[model samples]
Target: MKIARYEHNGFPHVGIVNHGKVNSLPDGTDVLETLNLPLDAQYRLQASAGRHHRVPLEDVRFLPPIEPRAMRDFVAFEAHITGMKKAEPGDGSVPEAWYEAPAFLFMNPWSLTAPGADIPMPPLTKALDYEVEVAAIVGTAARDVTPEQAREHIVGYAIFNDWSARDIQGREMQVGLGPSKGKDFANTLGPWITTPDELEKFRLADGRLDLEMSVTINGVQTGSDRLSNLSWTFEELVSHASRDAWVGAGDVLATGTCASGSLAELWGRAGRQDPPPLTVGDVISITVQGLGTLTNRISPQTSTGVPVPPAWSRRQPKESP
Candidate 1:
């Protein structure tokens, strides 16, 4: 089942998409209330529930499908890792343990915007970049989950754009923080969350997760890759995150970006040229196979200049009276 949140007449809401119309629901934003509902259940509820209504597809705005109880974005794509290594060889690919260890970095929830919304260019940031990623939403709680049981916990998948500030990220990593500053600002997620049952109907030609994807900037394709190339599986990531942590419903887990989804394309193989970064009004679109496209516009942040000190400071401490 496809679960969605949309906005109409400036008020946000939850809905189900069927035959091109968005049927609105009158419930709190509790995703579990209707997420992953089978088509039969959905139809039954629409007919029986007086709170349900439908809106024309062209009139509503889409929001991220799930309000995750917790968000954990993992770096499981090898191509992104290797590309970053080649882009900045000094950085080097993560240690082998990282493959087995399955690490994740936290992203700012305040930065989240809808699929078609305009994203703001951060103040004083010139090295703005995008990463294409896939994320899974958990449907049930699982601690110390095994790979075989991981699939049951997954509710669905969606496309994510991990907008980054490379300069701030590099500085923070040196302090062993792992993307506290560089990774904040903007994280785009939307289109819709595809339930596990829907995904089960499709598989890569090689029977893997290698889905075709691309990232375009200003109507130009900048990078492209496949999900099949991931170094680790989604199960491994789930297992890793589940250890000592309570995996609960609405938890979002991001599978890292693939090879071509790095900033090196705009930068260089070694060191990039001076200040190859995003300016206001740049549009970025991240597309994943089956999942719809997530498009966002980058605009300059509104600034009010630096503030001046109070008159008391200008007058000095008055001889420490």
Candidate 2:
């Protein structure tokens, strides 16, 4: 089953997509409130959505399916890791620590860009890139769940894009901290969400989903990889996330960039960038086999606020390169 949030006739709604048409949930259904519902209850809601109005899917403008309570992105693909390592000035070997456990970074949950919206470039970044991923939507609240238990907590998956600023990210990593200003600007999830049952058929012999994931920029294919390439499954990532912490409904746990899923990965593979980085007016479209395509155009920079004086007496920070 596929569920989407869209705007039709100048009004926003959440609905189920079936047979190239959208069947809205009962009128006045609160989106965030529905996230707390049990998986069975949500399925029942989808089953009853047909009782409401139905219309062509193309007639509606898509939005991010959910405004998550928290957003955590994990590095789950070895190919992406190796590709990233290759770009560094070394033997291009995978870190030994990576095999021990999954690594993740928390991102701004408030910075969601809907499919088809203009993605504004953050100020001071010229090397804009996109990370195509499969994001798992948490269904139920659980603390310290095992991988199997975490699997049960997953309600659905959506196509996720972690829009990045490579220039800023490189500098941030130099400081021994995870990405900060470089990552919080924008992260997109959309096209729609698909339940795990609908995707079980795509599982490979290794028990990983074999869904094809691809990305294109300005009408040209940039890279593609199968979801089966993910080394750490969503359940493992979610379970690790729940260790001593609570993972509730509406939280998003994303499979980080797939093999060559981002332009940064492509740069790693080729030693140097030939096509250069994204600029104004560039359009990025990402597709996950079962989920749909999410496209966003690059717009000018966005300003959260003007610079403010430092709160500390003598902790002046150096200027960003």
Candidate 3:
């Protein structure tokens, strides 16, 4: 089933999408609360018979499928890693540790926006980029789970756009820490979440889903790849993420950018100078087969309250004798 969170009549609601129509759940119902329940329980109470107020899809504004409790983005595709490494200033090879375990970083859940929202270009960056990915929503709480058992804990999947600031990210990585200001500004998820049952036929024997993912910028195709190209599966990512930690319902685990998923990778492959990054008024549309497309336009930069120092503020210090 395709589930969506939207605004109707000045209030937020959870609904099922059918033939471009939205059938809203009863008032005051929280979609995240239902996602926390076991799959069987969720079906019985949320997806089975319930009073639904029908609304036209065009009449409602979309919101992130759920207010995620936490967000973890994993680097599960080798092609993406290799492509990024080639673009970096060092040896273009995948790290040894990356082959042993799935690597991920926590993302700012509060930074997320819904479909059709305007994403402001953060003032700190001139090289803003977009990553096209697939994300899975955790259903039941998991602790020390195994790859074999991880699938049961996943409720649904959605398209994820992890906006990036390459210039800031490169500088931060030189300090041996993960991205901070570069990534904390914005992330986008939605259109809607497609329940796992609706995707059973796409599951491959290796535990990865066979989904065609693509991205277009202002009507031009930028990236396209098959989810099956991932080196590490979502199951492994989920199980590794839960090791000695709790992964609660409503948590999101994202597959990192796919091959050719970002301008950074494209520039590397073309062996050319970096192209102008996303600017105000540019529209980005990310589509994952069966999940739906998420479209957002870039808005003008908003104030961050932190001022940049003037060039004269960095006068060279006197050399020691």
Pull out the clashing pairs in model 1: 79-259, 210-227, 210-228
Residues 150-175, candidate 3, lDDT per residue (tens digit)? 98888889999999998888888898
Off by over 4 Å in 3: 36-52, 273-275, 308-321
Error of 3 at 160 (Å): 0.7
Residue-level lDDT of model 1, residues 33-117, one tens digit each, is: 5664665776675564325568876778887666665778888876577657655546565567766677787666666778888
User: What is each predicted model's overall lDDT from 0 to 1?
Assistant: 0.73, 0.86, 0.85
* Clashing residue pairs, backbone N/CA/C < 3 A, model 3: none
lDDT (10s digit) by residue, model 2, range 45-130:
87888576898978889888988889899998998999999887779999899999999999899899888899887887878999
TM-scores, all models, native as reference: 0.84, 0.90, 0.91
RMSD of 2: 3.7
Off by over 4 Å in 1: 26-29, 36-53, 89-94, 204-207, 265-270, 273-275, 303-321
- On lDDT, the leading prediction is 2
